[model samples]
Target: MEGHTGCTTKIVTLCTFKLSDAHVHYRTPLTSYFISHTSHLTSHWQSITLQNLYLIPHTSYPIPHTPYPIPHTSYFILHTSYFINNIYYL
Candidate 1:
């Protein structure tokens, strides 16, 4: 379990247990365990996305000893715009 305190902060709860040796002999309730695991995974993924941000951009690495050591104008422009957008949103 963990929590944070900001606009993106979130509280998360996790539960895990192992069946005892004697309890494992009874397999009737195994189906319910699978269902609970699936639901917990789905909720965890949703909560993670809600607490984080992502960015995407086209990128190129320049070769050394070349006349141009940086990305081309088009790629540079795309990366610059991405940075500006994130800054504005934040």
Candidate 2:
């Protein structure tokens, strides 16, 4: 989050929602995410689907000379790890 907008303050927040509609085909037509940005320095809001959602405190990688090496992305990605049906997030 450094040098992105020339702001050193970290107010980034990652929000994720996992949705599963029980149907043989398309059953649910809903855009179930609320995202808004009042300012450029506001926290980051992202809407993504996940089979399993887990929160990690911090993540590290083998990148060099990176201000924020730890990714601020969602801890769980959609349809990758855990699999479940009829999962509704509220």
Candidate 3:
């Protein structure tokens, strides 16, 4: 989709695969980036939205953006709802 002319989409997967640190060390850069950010195991879960939506370990606002290669085009508050406990984007 990177080179394709029109791919206005962000894929979200309900990932259930178990992970091992040893296994992740060899992942491709794109996947490794995602796994690294989400690998933080947390007991406390909450969602907050500013320019982007984030699922952090605490109930706070202004969550950090997932560091990845693609650049964000634009931002707006797109409303949020309760989720199953994972990072989300607005």
Per-residue alpha-carbon lDDT of model 3 for 1-89, expressed as tens digits?
Answer: 11222112332221322223211212332322222233232212123211112322322323255343222322211222333333354
lDDT of 1: 0.22
lDDT (0 to 1) per candidate? 0.22, 0.26, 0.26
TM-score of 1: 0.14
Query: Could you report the Cα RMSD, in angstroms, for every candidate shown?
Result: 20.7, 14.8, 14.4
User: How do these models rank on TM-score, best leading?
Assistant: 2, 3, 1
Give a tens-digit lDDT track for model 1, residues 1-90: 233323321122312222121111112222311111222232433332222222112233322223322223211111211121121111
What candidate 2 gets wrong by more than 4 Å, as runs, is 1-48, 59-79, 85-90
Task: State which candidate, 1 or 3, has the greater TM-score.
Answer: 3
List the candidates' TM-scores in order.
0.14, 0.22, 0.18
Query: Which TM-score value belongs to model 2?
Result: 0.22
Candidate 3: worst 10 consecutive residues by lDDT? 43-52
Candidate 2 lDDT tens digits, 1-90: 111221122223322331332111111234222111212212333354333222222244222333333343322222233544222221
Error of 1 at 32 (Å): 35
